[model samples]
Target chain A: MGETIDLKLHVWRQSGPNAPGRFEDYTHYAKAIPTHASFLEFLDIVNERLILAGIEPIAFDHDCREGICGMCGVVINGRPHGPRKATTTCQLHMRHFRNGEEIWVEPWRAKAFPIVKDLIVDRSAFDRIIQAGGYITARVGSAPDANAILIPKQVAEEAMDAAACIGCGACVAACPNGSASLFVAAKLGHFNSLPQGKPELDRRVLGMVTQHEKEGFGGCSNHYLCEAACPKEISVKWIAKMNRDFIRASLRYAPPVERKEGYG
Target chain B: MASSQVLSFTRTAIGQKALVAVTGIILYGFAFFHALGNLQVFLGREAFNQYAEMLQSMPKLVWATRLVLLVALITHVVLVVRLARRAREAKPAHYRFEERMDPSEGILRRYARQTMLLSGLIILAYIVFHLMHLTVGAVPGLFFVRGMAYENLIYGMRTPWVAGFYLFANLLLGLHLYHGCRALFQTLGLRHPQWDRRSFAMALSITAVIVGTNVIIPIAGLTRLVGGELPEDPQEVLRTGEEKHTVSE
Candidate 1:
């Protein structure tokens, strides 16, 4: 049996989007939590106790509970996903904490990401950025034969590294300026590194970068806090790549000239 | 059509970042060469005054260089101010319990990175004061005589308050350069993963050289290490300057 430890949790509470929020002390209910329990599980225990006492339970976002879905995240003790490197909040276990320790939890803070409820933020801004140009145009036919593209091993590995980003928004939370450069760069790298994604490389970079700026995300000053806060360990190198590509595309990619007269 | 394309390009955030990087390079080059040129003060009155006269002889070249530096300085300041505003807007709210993820990072790196704007503004103010004190010789109470470069420098730096201001301003400039030198590469999309360490080393060396020479000049004057003896009359200093110029010619 795992050792059970008591904890003091100061969870952020917000009734609605427009409501004022504060950290509500949960010391009375968060007692005897198993050390093996994940952070979400610990929250569940606290919620269950609140529900039994005829009080409204805490509301937070979670899915899959395995850190793959990128849906669960919260700032704990001022760091996104707590202090463990490359571990999401859902995978953070209570064993990492000592008995009777106090944890302060808050939601991701950024102008682009608006608060929807307690511990849940409106992340539709990410969707808008992706919609701008996060994909390549492909034919709607039967699947192509395997290994036809013939991507080199190194290139494929690098693309896979960029693809490891889970869109968790932890990078935004961790950045002092709340910049989303890492997330946008990872997406650009994932697509631009592949042969199939090369045809629209210039357009993709240009569109996505402009969209990111339009969404109120800050520019990258290379502080690299995003790399440190990333649960997927996405490197800031992708941002450098994005920057290189953007400069090249802005210079060389000319817009199509307008015709003065139409075909008769 | 071409002009329109250029206009549209500059409107993007990346475009402004590229401009900032390019202008920063120009300013850095000016700082480096300016520091090296000013180091002639250590060689004593004749060498230093001759160097100043040589620069004054080429009026066209001096004005052209000044114009370029003026443009670069203005562009750098304006773009950085706009970028900083955008960054502030991006994060309208603050986290109540925010902490640095990596406490192991050096305090200098943290302080320099986070306070770029603050250091930059202070350095800009210093530049204005510096131009007034040395270049234009318009500061009241400081001894000034036209073309007496060596005497002006020695007399100006000997004052305790002026020397102290120079020391403080140069230290802030050092901090600004420490981050600016490294960030320019990233801004221009020139940084590669393999060259990260080398780039940092390059930035450190450049900042050290520029700051070292600039900081020492004032200290040299303050401690009487340089500037042996100044003639009481301004006309006497001018006579010596012209004599050296004629001899060199």
Candidate 2:
């Protein structure tokens, strides 16, 4: 339903963390281009075109090429998914872009986020923080059936939703303060919102938030930007939950006696 | 990273919000009191100027105030930066640019993170420029001259930039107070069933006083790009009705 178009892309290219970075430009010329071509497919065609031209392919990170993976993320001109809600890069189609548009695509910018080549960032920090107690230690013995424990459906649904976080760091990358309260809260909320998670919820939130602070991330100012950018549509309301949990834990929960400060 | 030092920001979404709120309250409290105290300068150039003179005159008090404020300011800033860093570190992928009516929107809306950034920068810039304009103009320690005394504040504020920044400072302070006051109460759980209105009212009043006083002084003193004085004590703000009528009559 639309005419074919050509566009220029300015992408961030870096060899590694300690390496200097520069913007590399590529032009895509295409015909019979379906307006509905997914963003990744558009990139696929561009890469194919480059291959034919004997030019080095533009390097970008993507997996699943589907919205679920959260691997194929780019700001796309100036939006997380080219200005859509609950959509990831793979779901983003090229119909959003017009002909001859100059797109600036860059990786997440933050001191903690060391870039690994093109748009890929070293996001192991997420893993480390997650490992710091984003889960529950309340073991459900096999003797108990799933029905043995009663959980309110609303609470269960909320917990499942919080648990839905795919560990995508889009929240952090989207923040002006580079705050990770949303991700941390989602993880904290995942377990805390459930009955099985009730026992260690305190310890989990305390440990995670503490680890988060020590990692040099800025604190949330409660702007709720993370929710908007999150492909999972994780509500930043979990941040409110996390804040309440941390405060409660500090006052009541936490280890019976404090260990040496920062030991864990 | 001690339990005392760390204080946990990523615990829960609500918990993070609480931290934002609690710290915000602390910061706002300090600013409100500081601004309210600064308004004493308008009570008469001599009394106001003398206040500065007295402050510089006492080493122990000055040092104590500086030490205390430095600790407070540092702690506040560190917590904010640390919280922001943790949030960033926890996310695997970050967003690209998103549209905003203002930079302070979005996550910045949490509790004036953007305003904090802005006020922090503006305050930093103001401090340097202000010190250069005031203290550097003097022999550093002197900070005062018989001619260029605290009385010149109005004249000083007469400049658009100075007045504008002061107004900006007041607005920023208001933003800081708006969320922070409620947060402090929420953090301490001081909201009893009976005093909810009173508590919020107190917080709102304090903010209004600080913002209003700061605003009125600049506008009143520099209304004609010149200096004016208020009689000593807090009740003399109405004496300028002569000039008010001078404009009308």
| TM-scores for every predicted model | 0.93, 0.68
For model 2, state the Cα shift of residue A55 in Å. Answer: 2.6
Candidate 2 local distance difference test against the native: 0.66
TM-score of chain A of each: 0.95, 0.87
Question: What would the per-residue lDDT of candidate 2 be over residues B1-249, giving only the tens digit for each residue?
Answer: 123444533443335445456555555666677677677765666676677777678989878866766666665666566555555554444333444312434453354644556666566565556556555553242223343455346545655666787777667766666666655554443554478689889988988887798777667655742244433322233345356658888
Candidate 1 per-residue lDDT, tens place, A170-202, comes to 999888777899999999999999998888888
TM-score (2 decimals) of chain A in model 2: 0.87
DockQ of 1: 0.48
Task: List candidate 2 stretches off by more than 4 Å.
Answer: A1-3, A15-19, A29-32, A111-113, A138-146, A210-218, A251-264, B1-27, B30-74, B77-115, B121-168, B175-209, B224-249
Worst 10 residues of 1 chain A by lDDT: A255-264
DockQ of each: 0.48, 0.16
Kindly report the docking quality category of candidate 1.
acceptable
Question: Which runs of model 1 end up more than 4 angstroms from their true locations?
Answer: A256-264, B1-7, B231-249
Error of 1 at B176 (Å): 1.2
For each candidate in the order shown, give its overall lDDT on alpha carbons. Answer: 0.87, 0.66
Index of the highest-TM-score prediction: 1
iRMSD value for model 2: 6.6
